[model samples]
Target: MTSILPLILFVVISTVTPGGATTLATASGANFGFSRSIPLILGISIGLASLAAIAGLGLGGLLLEFPSLQMGVKALGSAYLLWLASRIAHSGSPNAGKGLAQPITLVKGCLLLWLNPKSWAVTVGAAASFALLASTPNRLAILLGTMFGVAACMSLALWCSLGVLLSQLLRTPGHWRTINLAMGALLTASIIQTWR
Candidate 1:
């Protein structure tokens, strides 16, 4: 239990941070409400857990050995994030009644984790740091996956709840638009953090 404290702290801090996933979840909650964001929240949690499992299976070592592969992933991830940011920035408010804009889908949410550099970093970092938590890679994978999945779910839900609260204060389309733009900008900024 003493040894596990660091891992728990790491997971909590990483998941609770204001990253791409959290920002998107917040926006989703504000735009569509908590119930509507469930799929996205689940998708992100599952995707991140899967990533940690895969990293435990030596994906991180593979990336270290092949620097070019890492660069390719970064490039692709950056492009995707930029595109997503643009979409978020231009999105209409739910209050606008703009033909009931659909919330982000489960599939997209999962895909976002795969393409998010920050997500990759967290999983890989956890897999590497907590490798000794279990006796074997398979066991490590399970541990990391379960831990990250639970932590991400809780943290993201909290972030989404915050957006729900914010939604109550933002009654106008213009206010929603401003928040959307700010969220979009923050998401874009996170990509810069990843590059750094």
Candidate 2:
């Protein structure tokens, strides 16, 4: 149990941070509703778990060994994040007249996890840091993946709930735009921090 303490701490901090998954979940909850955002939340948890499993299974080691490949992935992830931020910044409110922007789908939510540089970094770090706890790589992967999934679900739900609560105060397009701009700015800052 003590051996797993680090893993728990890592999961809690990673999930609670303002990353791609949390940002999108919050935006979805605010733009749509708690019910509409359920699929996105589920997708994020599953996708993050899958990524962690891959990392624990030793793919992370391969990426670390190939500096160029890792760099490429980071570049791509950064680009994708920038694009997502732009979309969020421009997204219209749900109550906006006809042709309202559609909410993020489950598939997109899952894809976001894959494109998120922070997810890859966190998974790789966790897999490498907690390697001593499991006797076998497979066991380590499964354990880490499960723990991450559970923690991600809980933390993401809280972010979404906070967004839903905030939605109550957002009565106009201007209000929603303000929220979206703030999210976008945070995401952009995350990208800058990643590169630094």
| Residues 60-146 of candidate 1: C-alpha lDDT, one tens digit per residue | 667668878878888888898788788778876785654227777888888888877778878888888888888889988898899
Given candidate 2, what's the lDDT at residue 19?
Answer: 73
lDDT of 2 at 98: 24
- TM-score between model 1 and native: 0.94
lDDT of 2 by residue, 39-155 (tens): 889888988999999998988777778889878878888887788888878776777732227766777777778877678888999988888888888998998899988898999
| Best prediction by TM-score | 1
Model 2 lDDT, full chain set: 0.83
Return the TM-score for candidate 2, rounded to 2 decimals. Answer: 0.92
Residue 101 accuracy (lDDT) in model 1: 75
Q: lDDT of each model, Cα atoms only?
A: 0.86, 0.83
